[model samples]
Structure formats: structure tokens, C-alpha cells
Target: MTANKIIFYPDNKEINVDQGTGILEAAIMAGVHINSPCGGKGVCGKCKVRIKQGRVETKTVGLLTKDEIDNGFVLACGSISLTDVEIDIPTSSSISREQILTQEAKVEHMEGIISRLDAGDSEGKEVFIHTPLVRKLHLTIPLPSLDDHTSDLERVYREINKLTGLEDISTKLSTIRLIPEILRDNNWQVTAIIGDGKLLSLEAGNTSHRNFGLAIDVGTTTVVVSLIDLNTGMIIDTEASYNRQAHYGADVITRIIFSRNKQGLDKLHQLIIETINDLILALINGHQIQQNDITAVTCAGNTTMLHLLLSITPSHIRLEPYIPVVNGMPLINADETGIKINPHGLVACLPHVASFVGADITSGVLASGMYQSDEVSMLIDIGTNGEIVIGNKDWLVCCASSAGPAFEGGGIKAGIRAMEGAIQRVEIDPMDYTVRYNTISEVKPIGVCGSGLIDTLTEMLRARIIDQSGNINESIPSKRIRETENGLEFVLVWKEDSGTLLDIVITQSDISNLIFSKGAIYTACVVLAGKIGFDINDIERIYIAGGFGNYLNIEKSIMIGLLPDIDRDRYKFIGNSSLTGARFCLLSDKAMKIAEEIASKMTYIELSADVSYMYEYTGALFLPHTDMGRFPSVQL
Candidate 1:
């Protein structure tokens, strides 16, 4: 096998790969980020790059234009290095880390929960004690004499029992071997790390104050890791980045399909592990914390993500019956899963309700306090899949809709992730059909993101550039609204004003994709509520979770029918509730228990099996709905 050197321009980074390696694979090896929403299968033309120098063999040009092909543009996923190659990764195809979504909303509520747990207040109910998944206790064992000498391990266990009131603690033989040396060298005083009824490790002297844990949210698109101080339940720092498993696929179904290929599961698992390890390393290094001091990690993610994280086969998850390997995962050592934390540190994943209704939803339910609410509340997490949960203190029901990745910038003509320079907001004047837009970080516009797409659809509808059926109204007569070879498109930004120096337009096809995405989400909410014989408007509150949900304009979302049309006050944004729930479980044993109970109590309604789902989904395909009576608030 011949190894060829590939150089990526602008960054000037280079790597050596086998001669037949795909340009996308070579870039991955070089630690370069490229947008491949279809996971380097050449189905999506997002991995475009210019052949700056040397020979390359391309299997397909994909969506590249004739001019682009003439100018050396080829899909990186489809091109392989025939010789030493120099590739120019375009700005539009590069992934940016500057604006990754990490900030969470509803901080005061989380703070209140923490305060209540710390004060042991349950409002006349069972108190959720502040027992973190991992705890460190400093103990001074009385010196062992022959007259009353218990075995060294038993002596340590006795002291632990006295301190923690836990009688049946267990530990590994390796930890038992270290007890004698650790206890004697520290003059009979040592700190014991206990996690999930087991002694994880023993350290000399008082290391109790240095205890830390990680709360992780592994989304299909992004991975967030938060370092927390176990003693105080304070979040030290958080770091987030695009999930590298995205190199394989954009959604769980695609990844699940890929996992059936040779070593595909291993590859996906390794990519996610690497992504998590990198984030964990960033958090630990930034805070000057030792890896050993971080004793536990609590993870919350969709079922597929959790499966990939634990190296479990997820093929069954997307099969006919849609069964998962396990909805309730057992606690295991972090090293067993290749997470780069303390070797003996424990890892716990929040429970899942079903194949699609995963731990992320359970975590959201816990974080929203919807399960304990007296009034009915709804929780919707908008991503590649739209997960909806509706119920109150007495009951809960959930269903997942395959909303696709249109919201996350997949399957759109001029779409990208919500990163710096991506257009995130838009407005159009009805008088002249002129457009106004705001990019993330106020930088030069590169492309449109989920929120920007939603805003664009709403503004276009308001400006009458597009009708309710998501068809472009060409008769409006504006230079921005022009017919291209692909179809009619409405330009949001001219090439001169764009960061990529390309006109960013929303095509008729993009409009249709957005409509389908919104329809799926809206229909899921309606169907789930209707399943329980309740109207969507009957819910007292709607809590929106996930990073994409955080930036959503409630008015625009309802206008486009992505969200249900209800009282504006009923909507509340609880950003990244999955991560929040993971943090709660990490900090409170009672929260973890509650998460499990929520998973078990909730009933999963499979929408695909429902006979009325298609009927309701078809009705929702139009702006708001074909049934105008359902969207009285959207009087367009």
C-alpha cells in the first residue's frame, strides 16, 4: 500500500494516508473538520473541496455545478488521492467551533433545585438528599492491634460504614491491595472514593475537597461535557463540540445502518469516544484538575448515542420492532468504555423509555419537573428527531417523530450548522420584499442555520414570497426571487455580502424540506397529546429542550407550525435540559432514582404504528395546518 501526503490549504495542515484513501478520511486523520451531513457517503455534496495540486480520482461530482467541476471542485467524500494531493477546503464546508451551543437556560430553576437538595427540603415530601454518584470521605481508622485487629480491608470498611452508614460496600482486589499501603503511609488517615455502593479507590490523606465528576450530554450532532465539583455541586466549566460520529452519519438511523458494515460499529464507537475524551481533556486541563480526581461521569443522550458510547450494537434500535439492547444501562468503570477519566471512575447513563424515547428525554423530564407538576405540561426536543413528552404528575406519554436534519442544516441548499457567521435570524419587508438578517457573532454571513431557516420561512410567508404550501410566488417580481436551473429561489444574501462569497438562497426544495421538518415536529406534539385524549392547547406549559430549541423564536415557530399554536405564556425555553438532567443525576442520588422512575412510568407511543398518524401529519404539512381552525393564533 502506497502512502500519499495530502495537504489541506489555509490551515496548511498535512497528513499521510494510503493512496486510495478518501479525501474526507484523510482530512479526518489530519484533525481537520469538514461538513459531511450524509457521513461521507457522497449523498450530500457538503464535503466540497478544491484540488489545489496533484491528481485525485473522484467517484462522483454529486451536487457540484459544471463551473465548479471546471474549477476543480469535487466532493471530498467521493474523491480519493491518486497522488500526493493539495486540497483547498472551502469556508462553507469547514466546521467552526467558535459558536457551538453550550449555554443553558433556566438557570434560576436549576439553582433552586440545587438549593432545595442541599437544604434537604422536599416541601413535606421525601427529601432528595445531596448524595452525589461519587463521594469522597476522609477517615481516620483507629490503629489496628492484635487484640482487636480486623483485616486491613475490613478495618477500612468499618470506618467507611461509620462515616457513610453503608454496610455492604464492595471493592476490587486491586483497591484492596492498595488499602494497606495507602492507609499506613498516610498515618492511618486516608480518603476513600465510593461510587454506587462500591469503594472505587483509596487515596492517601485528605483528597475529599478535590472530588469532581462529569455530566455529559451526547447529542447526535454535538457533545457537551461539564466538570462539576462533587462536594459543592458547582459546575466548574463546560465544553462542547461537534460530534465526530457525524463523519459517519447525521442521524441515528444513518449511523445504525452504517454500524452493520464491517467494523462500522467500532468506528462509530471510537469516533464518539475520541470526541468525548477531547472535551473531557479540555475541561480537566482548563480547571487544573487531575484526571484521577474526577471519579464519576453521568451521561444523558438518545438511545443510539448511548449505545455507541458503550460500544453496544445499535442495529436493533432501528429495526422493524425498534428494540434497543437495553433501556436501563448498568454502572461500569469509565475505562471500560474508553472515556479518558480516572481509571477506576464510574460511568452511569440515565435510563431510557424506549428505542427512540431515550435517556435524553428522561433527563429532560426530570429537569423540567413536569413529572411532578400538578398541571399538564409538554416537553419537546427538536433535533434530527422530534421527541415529545406530554403528561403531568399522574401520567406521562412520549413519542418520537423522524423530523430529519433540515433544522440542523442538512438537506438545504445554503444551510450550515449554527456556528459563527451562520445566519441565525431573518426578516423580510412586505413592502419591497427586501431581506434583513443577523449572523451568529455578527460576522459575515456564511450560511443559514436552523433558527435562521425557521425565521426565513416565517418571513417569506409574511412577505408573501412563499405561499402557505411552501411554494415560491414568482409573480411578486423582485431580483431576489429568481428562477435557477434547480428551481425558484429567494436570495437572502448576495455573494458580495456572504462570508463564502456565494449567494445564500432558500430554494423551493429547501422550503419544502423545512415544511416537512416542521410538520413532523408539530404533528408529533398533536398526535402525542391526542393519544391521551387531550388537545394540544390543554397543556398548561410547553418546555422546549435541546440547543436548537433554545434559540427558537416562539412566535415564528408557531407561525411556521413547528410548535403548537397556544397561549404565548405557556411556552418556556429550558435549554439543554438533557445536560441539566445529567448534571442533576450526577449531583443527587435521588435525582438519578427519579430519572429511572420516570423512564419506567412513561409509556411510549410509536407513531408509525398509529393509523391516524399519517392523516394528522398530512394535515400539518401546510403552514400551521391545512385545518385552519387548529392554528387560530397564526392568522396569516
Candidate 2:
């Protein structure tokens, strides 16, 4: 095979490759990331490097115009080095490793016993305290006779309204027709189960023995629930399951686009509702509790997700300006939202600030104590969306970008949820290219989850299988290198060693999508922080919030520049902050006020409007970044 000596100039690193090896691949052999917004398909000509001294034979130039060619700029992926050549690789063309989302290095949960005692102390050290949400009750009343002169329905309505603060109660026609029979049979002593600002069921006499409430965090990829004992203001149980909406589309935007088709909205609605109801059934059945006992609910989710849950049309959100029908939705009944709780139970969704910065961020801010902190801090809820809250006591700012479902195992080929067989972490030998991976249960790996993906990206860089610029070296001696239809691929595992007989690898396309996903998040954080007249490092603490953060590897994440290279001690992890925040609000009215303030004070930055975002994104598409100064700890 004819070899070409491609000396990446300035750095002066030289590598010899066969005729077909890409210039981007040659650059990686020297350690660098070329910017490719369109995944190096030559569609985005951003990955231009100057061929300073050699004949470079070229094939296609999808985005390169005549002006670019005249300036000696060649798309690294499009043109091939024809001979020994010196190339001045511009720093602007480099891609850096993005900060991966991780669980906080430190856990900051309330002291279980202390929190319990504080909750009880205010109410005379009593075990029971009143939550703001209303409850259901069945009352027995005195019978009205002909001499008393009050109509049966009027008497019942007047007494019930006076006792419960509800107005002339409503019921189904069947219930209303049977009202006289029930009053006569029970001698005016009957039970009423209040739901959705109205009466749901009527029985005979006092029955408040089993009151339940459900607080759920509806993630684009997963749904979690915490069952609350409304009678005692205590969390009784929790349940989690995959969101059924994955079948439609992996990300919110994709799902929204899918929802525009015929019956897509209805299917999307039923899928999530079914997931929620299954969890409720799990909690109820596990404790031998009745479904009728659940008289109230609280839900927290991103704006697009909220729209889906409410069955609201989400087509407009995917369009320009990204407008949504409502941010802070009004409270409704369980029946209205298809929740299988008590029929008339109130389903209160946390209020949202904007289309991007929804209640999930508000709930996360509440849980992270962002509104109460005196020291400057950053709260990042790394989920399907990158919801960031930066502030302390004086001021607050928020922004959310669609990070795509890459982290949650959506876009990648061998991706799966962090389930039993999912790979959670990876460590690769630099000298030998051997690999060691940890699974969710240390079993045979099925697919790589978010944590595993972070570890893999870092390991690949450190091991030299890929350069800092995220390009694979097809010239490496290891059999892991293979020619795929998409491009060159590096196998993480061979088919014979696997559980499902599949060769697991990260493709060039995967790397491209990941770059954009993490780049968008990192650049958004940087841009938003810059707009606030401060840098990300100026904050005293960085709070990583969300379900993904609970199990991610912080060190590996930092090594990849997916997270800022700060003192590990400065980061704190709060698991499922959205749910925790809702729980706090459920336990104390004070939390609601705090949540409201966090939402009100937050200055949301729309990154889409800022053209500089792409510029920042271009700089971040490297191993640790073009400006290695930012990540002092990440060294080659």
C-alpha cells in the first residue's frame, strides 16, 4: 500500500497512513478533534485544515465553496493527503471532550431522622401534619323530615359545602338519582369521596382510613414515583419503570415530531399513562392498599413531556420560537389526566417558567436549595434535557437545551437503559488496547448506558484508539478496527465474547451526535454563564441533579471534559431532585414558596438566539477542549 506522510503542523506530529486513510483520521493519530457538525459527512465544512505543503487529492466538497478552496482550506474528511505534507491545523477546528453528566461527588440528602423530627416539631411534636393539598372525607348527616322543610339534595349540599369549602357538589346522573334512596336508606348519614373539585363516590359513614397521594417525576426516558401517606405526611414507597414513549421516539423533539402524525398523540398519551398507572398499582398491591385511598397527586416534567401528559398538541414546540400552549398549567382531576388514583383526586403539576425551563428545573431548584443559598452555585439537572439553574441568594438564571436522548441510550446503536446488562463503566489499557467494563450487575454487557458512554469516550482518548478530536485510527494493529458501511469503527467487544452475539462498538456517527449533544450542553452553560457576567468556575458549588447523576462516574466524566474540571469536593449530588423537591413541597408549604421564588427569580437564556453558541460548540468538540487551560486536570 502506498503511504502518505501527513505532518500535522505547529504540533509537528507526523503519521504515515495508507492511501485511503482520512486526513481527520491522520490528525487523530497525532491527537486532535476536527469539528464536524454533520457528523463528518462533508455536509458541514467546519472541519477545514490548511494543506500547507503537499498535493492533497480530493473527492467531494458538500459544503466547501470556491472561496474556501482558494484559501487552501480542505475539509479533513473530504480530501485525502496524496503525499508527505505539512498541514497547519487551526486551533479553531479542534473538538474537545464534552463534560459528561454525573452524580454529584458528594451526597447532600437531609438527615432522615432529623428531617422527620423537624417535620413533627411544628405541630406540637405530633406525628400528623396538614399538607396543602385537600383530602376526601365521608360524613354522616342528620335526617331532614317534612317538618324540617329542607329538600334532601339541598340539605346535603349545604352541609357538605360548609364543612369542606366545596360548593354545591356535583355527581353523575346515576348518583344524583340514587341520592334520595341513599338518604332515606342510611337516614341521611352517607359518605362522599371528593375528587377533581367534585364528588366521586358516596358510601355510608366515616372512611378516611386509607388516604394516599402519588408524587411522580415523568422523565423522557424513565418515570419514577414516590407514594405518600397523606394522613401522616410520610413517604411510604417508591416505584420506577421505563417510559413507554420510547417506542415512538427517543427524544422529546423526535417524539413531538412523531406526535404530529395520525393518532401519534393518543398513543403517546396512553403509553405514559399506562407506565404511571403500573407504578401506582405496584405500590398499592405491595402494601395491600386501596386505589381509592389516593386522593391527590403531584407531577413534575419538562415542558414537552408535560404537554404530552396533558394530551396537548406539541407540534408548535418543534417549530420556530418553540412556543408551547402553557407553561404553568392549571390543576386538574386524576380522571382528567388518566391517572388511576381516587376519581376526584387533584393532580397538581408544578408550575413552569418558560417553554424550555419547565417545572422539572423548578422542582430541581427547590430540591437543590438554589433559592436559599447565600453562596453562588450552579444546579444542573442532566436528563433528556440540560436544565441548568445558576444562582444563590441575590440572583438566579436558568436555561435548557435539548440534549437529545443520547445519554439515556437513545441515539447510539448499542444503547440501552441502565438496566441489568447495560455497561456502566469502562477502563481501557493504553498500551495493549484491552478493555474492562462494568455492567449494571457485573454481568455480560448488553449495551452501553450513559455512564458507560462517558467512560468509553475517556478510555478511547487515553488509550489512543481515538484522538482528542474524536476520530478513530483505522491503522491501529488491533482487530477492534473494522471497516463499517458508515465509516471506520472501533469494536468495544467481539461477537464471540458477548451475550447476544453482537459486536459492540462506537461508530464515527455516534461520536458526531455525542459531540453535538454534549457540545450544546457545555456551550449553553458557558454562554449562559458568560451572559450573567460570571464564569462557571466562579460559583462556590456545582450541584448535579437528576436520575442520571445518581449513578454516573464523576471522575471519568471530568476527565472527558463532560463536566468542568473543578475540585471534586465542590460538587454535590442530589438524587432525583425533581421528585425530592415535590416531596418537600408535599411535606411543607414552605417548599412551595421556595420553588415559586426560584422560578420567578431565574433569568432564562435562550441559547438558540445566540449565534455565538456554534462558535463555542466548535471550540468544545475536542478531547478536553482546544483551551486545555480550562480543564487543568485532564492531561494526555
Candidate 3:
């Protein structure tokens, strides 16, 4: 195959690829990101690019309109370049980092946890202990004499033992070689960097106050990093961005399939590392901190994400008997994992519960303090995979359901992620069937996001524009309700009101997809509760974790059967608990221990093996539920 030159406009990036290569692959090589939720299988029409001057062969148009095809628009994943090409990627098809939710939600309960630690109460102080994963201790060595001469290593260990009251301590040969010079040059004064029962480095003078660490949340869609002052247990700065590995897939299962390709696992691993490193660079640069000062990093993510972060093969996770490579990871050196921090810095990950229910849920359980409570509670993290945990200090159970990417804007027409031009709220007038909506960043609407989709479904139900089965009411007297070649569709935004200058409609098929997604989540929660001899209503409190939960409307979510129809007051949102838990672990070793306990104590229930799952899932496919008695609050 001969190489052909390809140029992408606006970005002005160029790359050469073998002839007949997919345009999507060329864009990836050229450092351009085009949204492909279907992972280049050509099912999603999102990877649209306009050909300015090129010879290309498109295998299938898929979702592209005839008008779009006539205008030289082609699906980047489906098109193959026969000769040199010049393609332009539209803003609607490009991924942006401006709106990735990096900040955790503000909740009184979460603040109370921090306040208790800050106040230094007896129990709180003892539990947290301010024992960071890495610590810098300033020590003064006794001056050596002819009568009491000892090796520099022994002298240093003797002082450390006396200070920490610990008998066992260790160090590397590299640090041992520098002890004589580091001790004598500083006049018997040094700051020792210790972690995991070993000395990492020794610095001259009192450098204890400069110690820093990172708390990382390696989410499937986004990556967040928080730089913290390990000495004082304070966050210095935070940064986040979209995971660049999304070029391969939108969800873990798809990524696992992609991993079977040649060098696919390595490519995914490198992409995630690049994303984290970029965020690390931004955080350190903004705070004027040195890379070497970051003595440790604590991470929280799903099983597949953690596996990919450490470059481990996760092929078995999606297969039968679905077992992960390691549910509980051991402490590793930062350099070994290619994380850009101190070379001797330690890296730690929160433990996982099962193949699908992973550290993110364990971290959530820890951050929510549910495992320590006497009353039963439920924790839910909604994404492509919906993880549910229910328990108290006495018992715990968890399950994960493959809810698909409908909530994150996949497999739906006119759907997108939570970005700057996305519609995130919707309302409809029951009298005239008119629609009102709000876009993120106050920009013109491009597409509906998860929250907005939920709002739309609820509003449609309330206004009777859609039936209980999510069927569009074509009999309604409104222009917004019309039939397309695909199916009956409801226009949320007219072409004139849209940033893309195209009508954004929610089709009947999109409604069914969302119903299936919501049904899977709701059914999983119910089944998990049933396995423990409980009901959904028996959960005294429900803690919602994740970025999606931060903006989600409880009323709308319940109305759509995505959540149980419990009392609204029983619901509490603990945003980004995974990151919060990582931060806690970075600041206190006790927190890390508790997180491991949470992972170990959890009893995982595999839903696939349960006979009642499909039967119960069928009942949840309708609005609210097929059994109206389950949703007493929803009167419609």
C-alpha cells in the first residue's frame, strides 16, 4: 500500500497514511478528535467530515441524510481515501474539554466529613490521623564522635526510629549511597521522604512543607486530577479533560473488543496516560510546583480503567466467569506506570469489588460513609455502566448493569454529551404542546444531553405528547410532532434555533433506546435489593454519585423510572465521590485501609445469572413502571 497525504482544515494538521485507510484513523494520526460514539464501526454518523477536494470511497452512509451526502459530507469512519485528501471537521462533530465537569458538587454531608477532620475531634482525628501516603519528616542527626561512630545509614535509621517510634524501616541502595553526602553537607539536618515503610528520597534543609500529592479520578469519559498539600491535607488546584481514548470506543465493553486488535491495548493505555499526564502538567504549572515534589498519586476508577492505566490486558473482564486481572492492586512506583511525578513517588489505586463493579463504587462507598452507618442506604453511579450498592456497616451488596451509552448521548438521534451548546433542561406546555429549553453555557442548542433527555421524557409524559410506552402522539395538533422516514419524531429545537442549523428531534427509536437503558438500571437496583431480602423503598437513603447525578433532576428521574419513586428528601447527591475518596486516601492512610475493607466486604451479585432479571426488567420498560403501585408519587 502506498502512503497518501491527508490534511485536516481549521486545525491545519496533516498526516500520511496508507491508501484505503479510513479517514477516522487518519484524523487520529493527525491529532484531531472527531466524535465517534460507535468506535468507527460506521453505525454512528457523528464522525462527519466534508471533503473539499479528494478521491474517497464511502462504504455506507448509515445515518447521513441524502442532502448531507450531496453536500460532500461523508462519515469519516466509513470513508476510505483512494488519493490525497483535504477534509474539514465540523465543530458539532469535534470533542471539547471546556465543559467537562471537574468540580465536585457542593453538599452539606460531604462538607461535614471535611469539617469533622478539620475540627480535630477525638474520633475524627483518630480515624483520619493526617497520615498521608507519603510524608516528609525533618530530622537532626547527632554529631558523630570517635567513641560513637556509626554508618550514616544506621545513624539515619536510629533517628527515624526514635522520631516515629517504629522499629522496621527500609531504603533503596540509591538513597543509601546519598546518605553520607546529604547528612554531612546539611550539617546533620535533612528531610526524609518516606512512604510504604521505605525511604524514597532525602533532601537537605527542612523541606517538609513542600510535600505534595495528586488525587486522580480516571473515569471512562473524563480524567480529573487534584493537586493537594499532603502536609496540611488541603487541595492546591484541580484540572480535568475528556479521555482521549474515546477515539477507540465510548464504553468499556467496546474498548475491550478493540483491545483484541494489534497494539490496541497499548494504544488505549498510552492515550489514558497522555490524558492524565496533560492534566498533571496543567495542575503543576498553575500552582508553580515541581514535578519531583509530587511524592504520591492515589487513583480511583472502574476495573477496566485501572487495568488500562497500568497497561494490563483486560480481555477476560467481558468474557464468561468475568474475572479481572487484579481486583486489588499493590503499591507501584510512579515511573513504572509512566505517570509524570516524582520518579520514586508511590502510586496507589482503590480496590475493586468485581469485574464490572470496581474501585469507583468502592471509593463511592467509602466517601459516602455508608459502610460505617447503622441505617441501610443505596449508592448509585450512572453512566454507560450503572453500578449500584446497598448496605450498612453490617452488610453490603453490589451489582453492575450494562445500561449502554444512551445516557451519555450514544445510540440516540440529536444526542450529545454535556458540552457548551448542549440542551440540559426542557419543558413543554400541556395546553399547546410548545417546548422551552435551556442550553449549557447559554449557547444555541446543538443536541440534548442526558439530563435534558430525562427532562424531555418526563415533560413529554406529563404533557401527554407521548404515551406510557413512549409512543409519540401523532394525533396532537402541533407542528413539532411530525413523521420522518425513520419514525415518528418530536422536534425539540427548530432549525432556526439550533447552532447546527439543523432540526434536533427525538425519534421514537431514541425513546425506546432510553427506555431500555433506564429499565436496565432500575431493574438492576431492584434485583440487587431483592437478593438481600429488601425492597427499593426499604433503602433509608439514596446517595447519587458521579457528574451525571450532579445535574440530574430527582423528580424527572423517578418519573422516567430511572430511579425509585421514593421520597425526594431521601435523595442526596455526593458528586464525584470517586475523586473525593481518592483525595481522602491521599491525605490519610487510614482512609485507604477503609477503602480496601469496603471493596472486600462487598458481595457482588451477577445479574446475568439471575432468572428474575429479565422478567423484572420487562415491567420497568413502561413510563414510571408497568405496575403503577410501585410509583405512588407519580400521579400522571
Candidate 4:
């Protein structure tokens, strides 16, 4: 056996390794996480290392070019050292920080989540920090004498320019009109909140102390806010509450319909912004943070949320040709945008790729880190709108699916988010048919979360509780199976334990929606694979990305054909990839460039417009798919 020293260039640290081990294997053995988007399968080619000196074996490369191979840029997962050598690892956030990739299976939620799945949190009280996506700052400028005769506006720009070194500043007519009066009133000492380098708001004088910004993610049923320190980009406080838009409807289509009515759009917009401002106040008081300190904001939501947030009409987007008033918009001042962010702050929204696939997909694409590679890769943001991205450096193809809120515990009688009291994951006794579970708070069960929903669906299917066609199998001997006003359901919780127990059964209607939703996503996966002639097996690594992805069971997900049938080892659940990506974008300009590049290179495949999609979707209605041979491991 040849002797080898596995050298890590991070902090210039080095470790010795046996000759046969690959760099990734050795790195894992050494506890170094060198950003592998493909879970170190060599398909993504992201884990590239420069071999200063070494010889090694390779696994396989579906992406690396001849020039790259010749230049000694090797895929870490595929290469095994045949001799002693040095490798230079790049600086990746995954390597430099305390990376939390998986959402602990059971995290504490406030309500509507833990009890149904019978879960309990062991992670302890979440240590929260307020980190506004944007911050507003006030600066005091000294009055100019005869020696400094520069124009007031020019003089103001000088102060900010000298302070931040940002040139080519831009602002609205509203802010520009008030500049002179504000400058003189504060004796040239003023506060200004900048958004994407543009001056958003300005006040009387030096009011810089209370800087703050709000980072928001708008879901169909919920909205989350993180109040932050804009200067330091630290999240000082966070508050999440259900999206009041639920009253309009549970999903985007309903909300879009709501947007079409006269005052419906205005009401929807007002309610959300009001909710944002309310959360901002609570967070500011909760953490003793200054609201005026917030100067800028960044929001990640579906297209509908962005449209509603902007008070733009979104009904046309639901129709054919699927055009939006604006797919992506530039930065606007907080006052104009009506966000809870500091009035002086700027509100910067993420770019949207399409109507169905919006900023959330862009955020997920950035978060997945697939854009930084030259290999073939895929990023799937599973939510009400299931956005799928397939490509690497050479090409990218995208498609959107209506996966629905079922994955997030919606539509079901007792379903919730991955918050304080939700039951997240579950396992059932095949014989006795009893249940054991984990929840968010480690408290008594109340309702189910996303993971529990998938677990229940999969378990019910395997136990023959539900059939291939998603039919409730009432013919079983269990008393828990019964009919209701809403149709069939299996009794999960007794009446005493739950608020209502008509037996929280998976209904025929619910099954149809679930199947249709899951089928759309599954169909897109197959169609994209067919478009490139790559089988699901060809995907060496499968990243189930997003907040929901972290808690989803791959086995069950595959068994139900929500995802492809691959080795459990091939899948990596990346929790909150969108937020992580947005955070990175906020933190580093380099990360922002990467996001733009990802958006530009990605080719969107229109499912509604595609002719073959209907056929593919129809074929995917059965459990584990209508084509059983596609699923090799399923015993049922």
C-alpha cells in the first residue's frame, strides 16, 4: 500500500491519509465539509480540488471537461490517491461556518404542529437573534461654510459616499424633494436608509442609532420575519405566525382569485404588511432592538406573495401565456413599499423566474449552491409550487408543479407546520397498528407537521390503509377506519386528545389533490430526465431542498413516488435552502453574483405549455407510480 498525506488547505491545515481514500472520504474522516452539492457523488463537479502534487483513482465524472482534467482540477468524491499529495480546498461557507444542513427531525413549533404527530423537541429553547434583511442608518453631517460651497445634495452624497464608498446613488422623487428641508432642519445632520445602494429615506437629522431591517419569507399559510442588524447582518430576533391570507384560501390559486376582486387585492396587501409591521414591533421589543436602525429589506416568497405584497394584480398570471406585470422588480423605499422595515430603509425583493416559479425558486437555486458548478445538477424547491431546476454550467432546464400545501400539513383535518407543537415524523406498528412519533415541542401532541403528513401517507399506503389509487381501504378489520361527512378517514387521535375527531382520515378528495400534486412534480422529474436522456439512477446525488425537505422521509417519499426511487444514501435533505441562500446573498456580494448567474443560466420548462406533460402526469397517478418497474425496492 502506498502512503499518502491528505492535506487540507483550509487555514492551511493538513492531515495524513491512507493511499486508497478519496479526498472527500479523507475529508469526512478528518471532519472537513468541502461543499458537495451532489453529496460527493462526482455528478455535480462542485467539489473541485487543485492537486499541487498527487496521483489518484477516480469514481466517475459526468461533467468535468478535458481541459479541467488536464489542468489537475479533480473531483474530490471521484478521486483516490495512488501516492502522497497536496490538495487545495476552496473557501466554501459550508467549510468556514457552523453549517446546519438538516432541520433537526423534531424542532419546537409554537402551535398547530406537534400534537397531531405526537412529537417532542429536545433541541431546547431556540436562541434567537434579530437580523433584519435590511437596516436604516442616520448620519450627522457638519454644516458647510464658505470654504465648502458644494450643492446641499452633492454635499449630502459626499458624506454618504465617503462613509460607504458607494458611487452612482439612486433614489425616488419623493425622497429627493425633501432633501433640502431635512438637511437644514437637522443642520445637515440626517439619517438615511439605503437599499441596494439607493437612498430610500431621509429624516430631519442625525437619527442613526436605531438601525433595523426585516427579513421576510411569505408562505401561503404563514409568514416569517427576522429583525436584524443591517450593519452586521446578524439576526437579532425572529417571529413567525400564520399568514392571515389563509382566510382568502389555503393556496396560491385561491389567493390569486382573491387578488382579482376590487378591494380584495388591497385588503390582502394591507393584511400582510400589517402582519409584517406587527411582527416587527414584537421583535423590536422582544430583543430591545431599534426599529429606525433597520435600513433595508429582502423578501423571499412565491410570485403571488410578491404580487400581493406589491399590490399588483396577479389574476392574469393564472391564465394562459402566464404573463406577470413584472417578473422581477427593482428596489423601492420602505415607505413606498409599505413594509414594516424602517421608513428610511429600502426594500429589495428577490428576482422571479416565472409566474408559477418565483423568487422562492431563485432563492432555492442560490441556496442549493448548484449554480457554482460546471457539472449536471438539479435543485427542487418543493412547496405549493414545486419548482424544479436541472443543469450545471453547460445548461439548465426548469419546470413548475402544483405540489400543494399537503406536504406542509394543509387540507388534512389536523395538520400544521414544523413549528412548536407539531408532530413531525411517525412510524406505525404493522401488526398491532399502534403508533409512535416525535414532535416539535417535546410536549403532548396537537397536530401534524409536513414530515408527519408524508409519514402518515406512506405508512397508510404500506399498511394497506390506503390503496395504490389513493383510496381509503375501509375493508380492513380496524375500527379506526370509518366514514364521515367529509368521507373516509382513519382515526389517528381520540376525541379527548384532539379538538375534533371525526377520525382525522385521509379523504378521497384529499387523496385526489395529493396524487395530482405529487404527480405533477414526479412527472416534471421524469420529463426533465427524458429531455436530457438521463435516468433517475444517473443522478448520483439527490438534494431534497427547502424547509420541508429536511423533515421529509426519503423512503416514504419514494414509496409514494413523491420523489424518485433511489438509494436512501443518494439523498440529502437541505433545510431552508432558500433562506440560507438569501442570507449568503445578503452577506457576500460574491454570493449575489452567483445568484444572478444561476438565474440567467437556468432554462425554464413550461409544464402548462408543454404538450407531453399531461401524458406524463396521467401515468404517475398510482402509488410508487403506475410503472412499478421504475420502483425497484418497494415491497408493497
Cα lDDT tens digits for candidate 1, 1-636: 998999998779999999999999899899898888898878778888999999999988758766578878899999899999999988778864444732332232243445546665453423467789999999898998879868888988999999889989899999988988888889999999899898988999999999999899999998888888889887777788788888877889899999986499899999999888888888788889998989999999999999999989999987778899999998988879899888888999999999999999999999888998889999999877789999988999999988988998899988888877889889899999888999877889988989999999999999888888989999987999999788899989988898866678899999999999899888889888899999988999999988888789999999988888899999988888899899889988889999999999999999988988899989889987898888897878
Scanning candidate 1 in windows of ten residues, the lowest lDDT window is: 101-110
Ranking by TM-score: 1, 3, 2, 4
Q: What's model 1's lDDT at 290?
A: 91
Better of 2 and 4 by lDDT: 2
Worst 10 residues of 3 by lDDT: 102-111
Global CA lDDT of candidate 4, please? Answer: 0.66
Question: For residues 72-158, what per-residue lDDT tens digits would candidate 2 score against the true structure?
Answer: 778887788777778876533443211111112122222131254245433232231354464556666666667887776667777
Residue 93 deviation, candidate 3, in Å?
A: 2.1
Q: How good is model 3 by TM-score?
A: 0.95
lDDT tens string, model 4, 1-636?
Answer: 656887776545566777787777787666555644334545444466767787778766554445446666678878888887787764321232111111221121222112111232232312113223343456767677899888767776777888878699877788889988888876777877655667777877655556655667776555666655556555565566556555445677777887798698998898678767776777778776666656666777778888998898889889888887886577676778787655666676777777877777777776555554555566777765577887765676778876666666555445555655466767767676676767665655656767777787788787887889999887887777777655777766554554222223445766676777778888888888777788767766566776677667778888888888877786766555555555555544455555666666767777666777788888799887888998898879
> How would you encode candidate 3's per-residue C-alpha lDDT over 294-386 as one tens digit per residue?
999999999999999999998999998899999999999888999999898899999999989989899999888898888899999986678
TM-score of each: 0.95, 0.75, 0.95, 0.72
Worst 10 residues of 2 by lDDT: 97-106
Measured by TM-score, how close is model 4 to the native structure? 0.72
What would you estimate as the lDDT of candidate 1?
A: 0.87
lDDT of each: 0.87, 0.72, 0.87, 0.66
By lDDT: ranked, best first: 1, 3, 2, 4
Best candidate per TM-score, number? Answer: 1
Error of 4 at 160 (Å): 3.8
> Which window of 10 residues has the lowest lDDT sum in candidate 4?
108-117
